[model samples]
Target: MHRGVREFIRWVEAHRDDAEIQLNPPATTSDIAALEQMLGGPIPADLRFVLTRFNGGVLPAGELLPAGIEPGTIGHTVREYAEAVGGDFLDTELLLPFHKTPEGSLLAFDRSAGPVSDTWPVVDYYQDLDEHRLMYRTFDGWCRVCVAEWTSDDFGADFTLETYLRSGQRHAEVEPDVATAHATVAHALKRSGRPADSLAAYLQAARCVPPLPWCDWEALKIAAILDDEASAREAATRLASYAPAARWAQRETSPGRVAEVLGPIVRRSGDPKPLLRLLEQLKAQADEEEGPVVEAILEALHAGKDLPPVRPLREQSVVPHVPDVDAWWEASQAAYAEGRLRDDDLLLDPDMVRLGRLRPFAELLHIRRGF
Candidate 1:
């Protein structure tokens, strides 16, 4: 057996006491042979070893699909998913699905990568987007991540703020240039009740390439809460510069949206003139609806009155197309209330909260996926 496979099994055995994890009996040799015949090729040696020992069952992060079609083996689903994909995104014949993630995606082996099945890479097939995302270079590589995730209680009931923070740091170390990792770390710190550290992390994220406006927005809020005037000013300035290009700015309510954030800063600064100048510049380039909103802010500034209150902004989920997320959140809340889960684990389970897995690599850096 491969080292990664051995390590994974050891970890699974170590945590076998957890009620949420289940390891079925090993696959019979004949069943394994039948599976290979069905695939029209030999299986990866490491995978065959895993099947021989544990067959397939549930893990915290995802389900290990069994071989030989015992209700959850994904026999026809593979071909159906491939057929749905239709395009040149994948080679239908060589795709062998082995795992099903909580997000309803399949982790499949792309057998066309090389002659040896062991060298084939694993790819995550997203049903919603009809896309295949390369997840690991080899089956063992995926096992390595699984071992790490399971060993550290990632996606497990014991998940905590520290777990999230450590995961974020690991991702940042792997992809230093990706702003999302730093942002995830910042959010984790915020949840840990460390506003100062969170603000610093957000600032660090904002300095990354293509500087995320969400990072600046969050930093601005934290600075305000921390009563750090210098940091607040810096965040506000960046937000102002990004206002024109902001997605929400294109709407008719753009001016009010801008005012909601900028107004508070202006009020706090006790200098409305600078904001007025910025509004005037925006007005020159603004559309008809946008001009009126800018004018409203200017009117309030000139009269030294409070800016009109706009609807409070709500932070939206970075995860997309998960319609039943509210139910997931309610479950987390119930679990936390019942003492079955930690406060941090309430909404950070990679198995429960869809955003949990994406945060480290993608979600936190952008308002929406693929943006």
Candidate 2:
């Protein structure tokens, strides 16, 4: 076995737990190194990371070949062609470079073609010249198949492997169900009006259908239309809670909805205590999960305007102990100090600090205040 083949086998063996390995006899170390040098920068950290994790090697039979091709035939062809050409043609026919996309589609670029050559061998070389021009054009069909298979396995069913095989286009199709659901919810919410009863009905209607991208934005719009202060406050609180619950449904959900829903409520209520409390709870959740939902809530809070001052619960008031209260308190103070806490920090009682520490220093404060 060649040194390259041995190194490839060892790499594949290490990644045996992952997808099956496919063999490509033509990809050489020198070729890869040269390509990297030409790019004038390291390949993305992620690509290198996957390569190291999987190691490297020839894929198993029927494993890394393209969706509909036979791996045995691919291997046989390469060997027969190599023997016929007395191995000298190996440099031109065997060496293939692969480029993988984030969506897990792979394209094989034939480096043997002088860089000045006009003709390329992409899946769709000329059908849509401008778009497909950048696609991977492998020297051999087998190399293309091998790359496509590797990419499909990495991305799994989420990637559109067939699209690449049929036409080198990577357009993602939007599901109709999501579009219709969003439209239905948006229309229902927009038509509903003011009174608490009407608003409640509207909210219920909005909740009936799962939020999709279109309706996700509409949900905030409906929340924004609240006319009564109390109604708006309730809507805001409900919307904040709803964001997390409906997150999975909104494929394209953005954090801005949280702010859009809460902005009106905070401005109309005159008291920012509820918003602050909500923010605190969200911050706690963020610490625990560190997910998109929490990040969005933090962003929304940061962008809100005209928020009322947060009144301290009370001096010496017994407050319920929350997990990581000290850390939460410190973070809250930092946010307040940075002016990200809005004007609401004032609503927090200096006494609340005592609850965390269980010390009564009211007398010391009174002395300072000239009481």
lDDT of 1 by residue, 292-342 (tens): 766776778778786664432233322222547665545544443344533
State every prediction's TM-score relative to the real structure: 0.47, 0.24
In candidate 2, what are the lDDT values of residues 64-152, reduced to their tens digit? Answer: 32111122322233333345435532344332223333333333333344543223333221212211222322223323333444444
The candidate maximizing TM-score is 1
Segments in model 2 whose C-alpha atoms lie over 4 Å from true places: 1-202, 209-217, 242-252, 282-371
**Count of clashing residue pairs in every prediction:** 0, 17
TM-score for candidate 1: 0.47
Off by over 4 Å in 1: 1-60, 64-99, 103-146, 153-180, 205-213, 229-255, 267-290, 298-306, 311-371
Model 1 clashes, total count? 0
